[model samples]
Target chain A: MTHPFGPATRLALVVLAAASLAACASTKPAGPVAPRGPAEPEAPYRPPSQPGPVTQEQAPGVTPGSVQDFVINAGELVYFDLDSYTLRADAKPVLDAQANWLRRWSAVRVRIEGNCDERGTREYNFALGARRSNAVKEYLVSRGIPASRIDTISYGKERPLDPGSNEEAWARNRNARTAITEGAR
Target chain B: MFRTKNLFSVLLAALATLLAAAPIAARADIVVNVDQGVTQPLPIAIPAFGGSSVGGQVSQVVTADLQRSGLFRPLDPNTFVQKRIDVNLQPQFDQWKQISAQALVTGQVTNDGDGRLRVDFRLWDVYAGEQLLGLQFTTTPENWRRLAHKIADAVYEKLTGEKGYFDTRVVFVAESGTKAKRIRRLAIMDQDGANPSYLTDGSYMVFTPRFSSNSQEITFMALRPTGASIYLLNIETGRQEALGHYPGMVFAPRFSPDGRKVAFSVEKAGNSDIYVMDLGSHATSRVTTDPAIDTSPSFSPDGSQMVFNSDRSGSPQIYVMNADGSGAHRISGGGGRYTAPVWSPDGKLIAFTKQEGGQFHIGVMNADGSGERILTSSYLDEGPTWAPNSRVIMFFRDSAGGGPRLWTVDVTGRVTAQAPYPLSASDPAWSPLLN
Candidate 1:
């Protein structure tokens, strides 16, 4: 196949390679060459680094409208009290950021997964998880996200984030997570 | 999947022989009083059945069944002074009495010459020197296990004067994977933990599989990341379908006594309410309008009332209301939080799981919520299901830092044992007596 890069772009790559070599050489010690043992293996090859700032849309891995972007930029998890579906005060800011993120990506559809600790019975925890997820969904709706764009599910005590049986693990397991389902890059 | 044939001719012959051979009363005097809080297990002898190897297997199954019930202590075959007793002939009452065996079970398995097996069993009152029960069952060779359970049921009923729960099945959630990303599939097995198979793949999560009165259909909840839905599955046909479309999360599905309606919960905007759907008409009716959480609805045997779990009383407690959702009132009157109330098949009691002081217990109360009794206690024990006879309750127990396992307890709290299967299991629902 023919080369895809033009002469000008190739020149730009050569300049970037020279700058990287110069930087590496400056880090070496300025002393006489010592007697070397056997020949050492060459260092692993790395691509030349671009100097300009990359926009969110042009990020290397996570694109702007991707699920990773939604998960990393805005928080996806909110914790609840034991046997209580009422969102904690600290959960408000995280959910607010989620709502703002959803607004910016209006086409994205999300599913709220409610989970519980192993302290409660199966059916009751199922109901409690449903309540927690709906609590998150309603808050999102109140923050201008459309209700139609969101769905909810309750994993009950079946899916515990922390398998430990202690109070700290239980506190961590009893939470709701937002998952971007559709219309993401 | 085998057909059972009742050998009436053989039964009549056995009955005639027993009636003519003994002068004592045929009824067994040594009865098991299951209602008493404490009673000694009756010592019975069950030697290997005569005939082929299948006979030995059947006898073993019967022995296990009676032994697991905690009502009978089967004497070791080595302890039997009179071995090799023929089913067609009477046992020596003197030799049996020497070993202190109150009752004896003798059986024979023979090929019926057409690739089928015939089983003949006789239950003897050793002290009275008379046969209490005799019957014959014929089925395919592969169906010997079921025939063995049938024999055990007959013996149990003849001795205790109550229906037997041996000829049944249990549907449960087979749990695998870690606690955070557990994969739950619907599974079932014989009451004695035989013929186990998974009905659903472990692609999504499933919970609370419940059997209908017919024993062939089940209703359970399947949860996915997007939403939750209730499904009806036919165990025989391997046919499954979603119940219907709802605007909210639907779960906790259970069938009515007649198997014509399903009662479940629907949650919208963080509030859950109970609803009943008629399977024939496809019409749904809202049963509870309370603003509080109302779920886990179990119907009475007569189908006139429902027992459900609710938080309307400020905490999770058992509640009973009319079938049409009238005259609602709280039934549980204890300190701990009570939930997952299931009415017994006989309509006499309501079983529930109680959480208190960092411990969970399986308990039962009268229909009016009086005469409360705790049967089993552990780190976590929940979801008690009633055997068809309503004499036994099966529930799941989760130990500290361990997965859940199935366990059973008699109503009197006299017997508690782990299920035969060793896998992690939960949410067991016992089926009605198989037809």
Candidate 2:
């Protein structure tokens, strides 16, 4: 069969496509620019030597035994399957790292925050989230962290990490996060 | 339910005498049988009241109230052959019969010249040509809407042999913002979605606000990043107090039928169970000891039995047990996940949210789990609350990628409509009819 469109319509389509391409091209930055320092420094700045790989304790800006350090060196979140409190296989490593971090910072008191996706009802999800946070707390306690140093709260589906209504967002939302509620530097 | 039925029969017997003079063949009374699976709406005509602007507005409100019930079809004024009506005088039955109106409502509003408005209305059975009800209400001029609702209630009760849900209020959680950071506040409004006011300032998230039997108090759960708390709030006085501290998260609070106690769920160390607390004594009792999730406890109208949600059978399902937590047995059967089971005020049916086939549904079933009926199905429809009359159920429906809005469905599933509120809302709790 012949082309479905006449010459004028085909010409208009080509023009529209070209206009969309121009719009897309405009979104990209033209080039990279050098960073600018502050106009004035409180004290004369000294250029330090290029630093080698440093431990989290010696890292710049991140204080040792702090909330930021725990978040950076050890993952704070572990995800669960939908409508489940069973920790995923991949989540085991994260919780293991968290357990080790908590053991090192023995004085840090943490709260395990449990959450769920939007698929469940409000009251039921609250119970489900409690189960999830408890799952994390139990795992940590099993790995040598004292139970007394930890607290748990279930946000249910009230607090969501991802707002999208798709499976990926729901996966991210069903999680338990270890929050440093006290004893952080 | 038995008390209301007795009252209805008594009213019917009294009205029978008024029809005694008519021929026996024409003595059939007008009644709407609401128990059937399908019902044809009774056609009624409500003309503008005779006196002032408030008169017309009152008539409009009364008309709207009856229309929204899905039990009455208010005829258009253009179809009214009788142009004028007087509250004290009889209507022309021939004109009403010609337009197929089974019931006629006539009323007049008078300003007493002392800042009070006097309104009187009469409900007539057009077929029998007899007055079924005549009542007058006197109130401040600004309270015309409530007066109109009272009149609507009178008409509904006279025709259907059941109490009316008009003149009541609904307490719900008004939600705004994105799902990730939603702001939910306790909100209340007239049953028709008028005179809405926020009871809480949307600072922390609130959920599942349930009205007490008296309609003056509500118990709701407020969730914060730190923890969760259940609060009992007196709506009339704006006085609120936390339901005391528990060892764990406390949520899903609901008042007993008599409004003397509150039942809620407390979660500790990943396990959740139901508990009840007496408001007067402040004594708390554990209702369920199941290791699995046991939440959302709703009491039967007589306060003898409790229906709640549980997952002990490996999936979320509804269960019924004694008020003291004995003889708990699963009441929900089938393949769906049933949650949020609320016992109807009439104590005949249980409403719930069922999730099956990747779709959520609002449904009701007999208290024994027999005669299951799904009223609505959508991407998400949850948290079903029964109207005071138990004929209608209000719930929230959340669209994919959108916020939730309140919706109502009658028991027969024959009529469904979105609530008039224009914001994201959920967890609707309908109050009992105002005294």
Candidate 3:
């Protein structure tokens, strides 16, 4: 937004006659397209102002089927093997149930949070977490759910379900979880 | 939230120790050996300065700086044969030699007529009884630490023939709170774990902060509930700008060698790809097109090629490609998962994080993916960032009982030291040597 109009376009003028200065010829040139920043989104750079620790317990506050109920009945959590974003066959039934539940509460929007174990690098885990969340969201969308209804966020290894460092804990941590962020239908 | 200004302030106390070192120089004419295996830290003595009380504190800073480099062992002050050696005194070679001190560093700090701190230091070879290096600096009292760092650099260079990294800064993420409610803020500190100050408030989760080659600007990933965005923060001005707004999650952001472009990863439709964006035009071009995850991009020193981590090989491994996304080839072989490949400053080697067994390691390999050597292994030792000299790497190590803390490792794997910080820290990005 700080860039001004007519920026990036430099025009040169040549006066061949004494009176030519009074009669100016102008031309509009093709200019590069400028990408609009998120200034319209009210402080786009800052996250939501609620600064605190993040955890799964934050999911129980939603209306229709308590967020915890959605986790229990619809199987809102999906687990992935090490270094693999591909869901196992066991994850399909959970996605099917999640899709059915989301269809019933069409007015409620959900967010899929992906996570990783603390094994790999943080940034790489971030991308892996992103892939995992989108994998879950893609499954939901493929099952007749609207893509717009599901938002995906990846916490990498920042938020772990269990504090243990063993295999059981890592397996449980490398998961994708779904929560209802918007009000329920 | 973990925003307590002193949520961990055990750091400043650690700075009280002197970090001086033994010289690599074996003889009067011998410079510090260039070989990593030839490390014989020179024994040096630095008595309290004669002039001001601050001079004594400054001597501690210099000693701490040198000792932290792992190249020198500062002798105990009680071991000084001479009780009070004056900076202006003639050569006390016999007194320093009596304590087996190979080098004697003496300095004096005086308040000039205008109140400036006029600091002078002399590095002497005890055996040769000749002054090895002598320098004086005049600065305001506020810059006393900088004066110490300058003296350390001079001593280190005189002995090792390599410029020291003490005069540099490290930008990292300082973490607080429990695992479920973690607060991560961008923090910067001296390379010797001094002068740590948070750059950003822990309002949002900040990740993957990397210094630009210019060292003035830092690009990192910030996550909010709405979405994740890549942002550029000016270190001096504290001005921040959204580098890019992608349709999906963008992470693992890095600046090009020239600071003119950035390479980052964006995940869309279950696929993650690396994209390079020119800073001037804000135009981005995708570097990887496969369905597999392709992220953690690092450009070669010459900027003609880029080495990045991709899962195109079934497991995440290192890959190399041209700057324009052509001729992509896999460079990593063997077992385990290889990710987080960072090209060295000299353009000849790449330092990376490898997870083969249950353990994670920091390793280095040639640009062609050959001569791979594992430097350090631990429960989790990832994110390898090379020093400007390519001789050292700083990474975060996390174990069962301990949280992640910054640590440095020599490429030879012989010298390992913790970048001591009182609080939990991670994702250390070393800046280019400052002016």
Per-candidate DockQ versus the true complex?
Answer: 0.38, 0.32, 0.29
Candidate 1 off by > 4 Å: A1-26, A32-65, B1-26
User: Of models 2 and 3, which has the larger DockQ?
Assistant: 2
TM-scores across all candidates?
A: 0.88, 0.85, 0.83
Ranking of all predicted structures according to lDDT, beginning with the best and ending with the worst: 1, 2, 3
lDDT of 3 by residue, B143-217 (tens): 677778878888888888877777678889999887766799999887877778888889899998999987778
Q: Which parts of model 2 have CA positions greater than 4 angstroms off?
A: A1-61, B1-28, B37-39
Using TM-score, give the best candidate's number.
Answer: 1
How is the predicted docking of candidate 3 categorized under the CAPRI scheme?
Answer: acceptable
Worst 10 residues of 1 chain B by lDDT: B7-16
lDDT of 3 at A24: 54
Off by over 4 Å in 3: A1-69, B1-28
Model 2 lDDT per residue over A87-168, tens place: 8999999999998988988999888888999888989999999999999999999999999998888889887878788999
Candidate 1's residue-wise lDDT over B333-376, tens digit each? 98999999999999999999999989999999999999999999
Each candidate's lDDT (Cα)?
A: 0.86, 0.86, 0.80
